[model samples]
Target chain A: MTDTEKVIEIQVLRYRPEQETEPVLQSFKVPFTDDMSVLQGLQYIKDYLDGTVSFRWSCRMAICGSCGMMIDGKPKLSCKTFLREYYPAGLRIEALAHMPIERDLIVDAGDFITKLESIKPYIIPKEPRTLEQGEYLQTPQQRDMYEQFSSCINCMLCYAACPQYGLDKTFTGPGVLALMHRYNADSRDGASAERMDLGYAHEGFWGCTAVGYCSVVCPKGVDPANAINQNKMNSAINYFTRFVTPKGGTK
Target chain B: MSKRRPYVRSMDGWWKRDAYFVKYMAREVTAVFVAAYAVVLLVGLVRLAQGQAAYEGWLAALKSPLSLVFHLVLLATFVYHTWSWFNIMPKTMPIMFVGGKRVQPGMITGAGLAAAVVACLAVLLIVRGVAS
Candidate 1:
């Protein structure tokens, strides 16, 4: 409790089942150093200011992808965002945008999880490999096809930043679509025909209007916009080539 | 335990909240001018078929100050429309590989813009040669 210490104001949107009808912002002034992250500021509020404030965070580093929130109306990883950036102006933190707030600073990610699973994030082999067979090897060029899209940590920030998803929750969304492209583009994966069914569907990659904020807000630089848009071209070609090619162009 | 009610916020006027959305909307709006210019050309083609008197009247209409201002606005929107279309084309198109190296996004935009400039110049030269 020193008078000389520098403090920053953090406004968190709080939701309680019994107390509030809807989420509302509550302001708190907390002392912060240059190194204090937005996640740490939320921690200070929970630790001292209010015990009820809830958020999800793991791996204090940015790898966990859990501490995502709408910081000043932008989707960001709170753990990676420092409080010093908004020292004088202060920050209004809310649960991730375009989602139902389950509680204070925590949104319902059930929809996101379902979308992730629907895409089948794992790789399906073209053919089963016998124990005697060697590992599936790919050239450097082959890896480059799907390399940049493989970095999604599923933080759901892309979902929050996506206006299409915000307007219509049915859109397959950026992160999951990027992950879908990651698996589909893999040299050894032979499930492109299957994934393209979902990719070309009305609610799939076609859902994106290409606002492109998904790439800008992404902490991992996964470029989900690029992945989804590339598939738009692929899907269109697949439609035209279904007659000419027996397997179609999804492969 | 009591029931839980999750508050889903309304997303009204969502595009107005971000500058990116404004830019995207602006890009989309250029299509209006594109359609307008197409209409102008269509009317011109119809006037040409109607006979010389009607074609001369259309030519006179094009020489009006109001039409000049309209054409100027059309030029600006067409430029922006072309730049934005090619600017986003790389993302919309499949990844390109040349000489075992991936083509850079900037290169794609640059190539597209260069091609557009070349095409415009060729059209200008051909129009001049035809007029001469």
Candidate 2:
């Protein structure tokens, strides 16, 4: 709103189902403060320049995991990415890669939600615990077994960074795989046998070629590639054991 | 009906656009060298089965300048494969705790590399002893 306010051009991909056949880049000049984030920059454009330019965002602090977008062609949380860093060079904002773009800067996340649900994200108790038995207890060491994988917020940036998922949607993908590992690694959980069926499948961990971009792009440090690759080893061992195990012992 | 036509992007050749992906592709390409080395060894074994004269001819071909160049290239790729393999090995394994603290990935990679060097040296010593 001031004469000296620094202005930067943000080239955002716009897609309107009623109008355009495909997404196209639409440029907007946004005046931003040094502390302003990319999400704030988009908000400024929506409030002042164009009300129609739509994007998803919630907690502005990267925790909500709703503000993921491709900033300069890399998957990133728009809320966590500062506008000042990309200043002078500006930035190109687009929907997360691989997934279908539902609208401007918004990818259809229905597939991800479905995959997340399929993993059985909740802990299936090893032993039925009654109210009198009290809440299930866990040692610090037990918590550490799955703590790293538990940090995934379902942002799907790992999915965006994954070429395997982009090539084949049938692949279980990274974020969901990490969530699967989280429950499996938990000591109190007895669903490992059930989850191993999915993990050992051809469409599961075998789909990942270990391109490793997933871990690098993950904002939560969830390292879904680690989870997926470790499961690949488990799958490999299980694969060899299936032939040797007693007839009815194998799944 | 809902007005929704979600646009899907192509993944084919997408790695060509990024340096990170290019490096990853290069690492993957190293597998060709491993396969080639295996094939060459298999040919040597076949030549040995054919008799001493055939084995000598096979060894002579390996000593040629072109084959030496291939060997050099294979060596470089082998080095890269070893380094990258150890770098990722820590991630693919469960966390190792020593003294109740998780071992660092860098430390794990360093240990793996050290083990590889010691094994190579032991192999070299055994080969030298056999030649003597």
Q: Give the CAPRI rating of model 2.
A: medium
TM-score of each: 0.95, 0.95
Among these predictions, the greatest DockQ belongs to 2
TM-score of 1: 0.95
- What 10-residue stretch in candidate 1 chain A is worst by lDDT? A242-251
lDDT of 2 at A155: 90
Instruction: Encode model 1's per-residue lDDT on B5-112: one tens digit a residue.
Output: 888999999888778788888998999999999999999999999999999999999999999999999999999998998988777767789998889888999999
TM-score of chain B of each: 0.94, 0.94
| Docking band of candidate 1 | medium
Say which candidate scores most in TM-score.
Answer: 2
lDDT tens digits, residue span A1-251, model 2: 89978999999999998899988999989988999999999999999889999999999888889999999999999999999999898999999999999998889999999888887889898987898989788989888889989998889999889888998999989999988999999988988878877888867788998888899999988888889988887787777787787742237
Off by over 4 Å in 1: A1-4, A248-251
Question: lDDT of all the models against the reference?
Answer: 0.90, 0.89
Query: What TM-score should be assigned to candidate 2?
Result: 0.95
Error of 2 at A235 (Å): 2.0
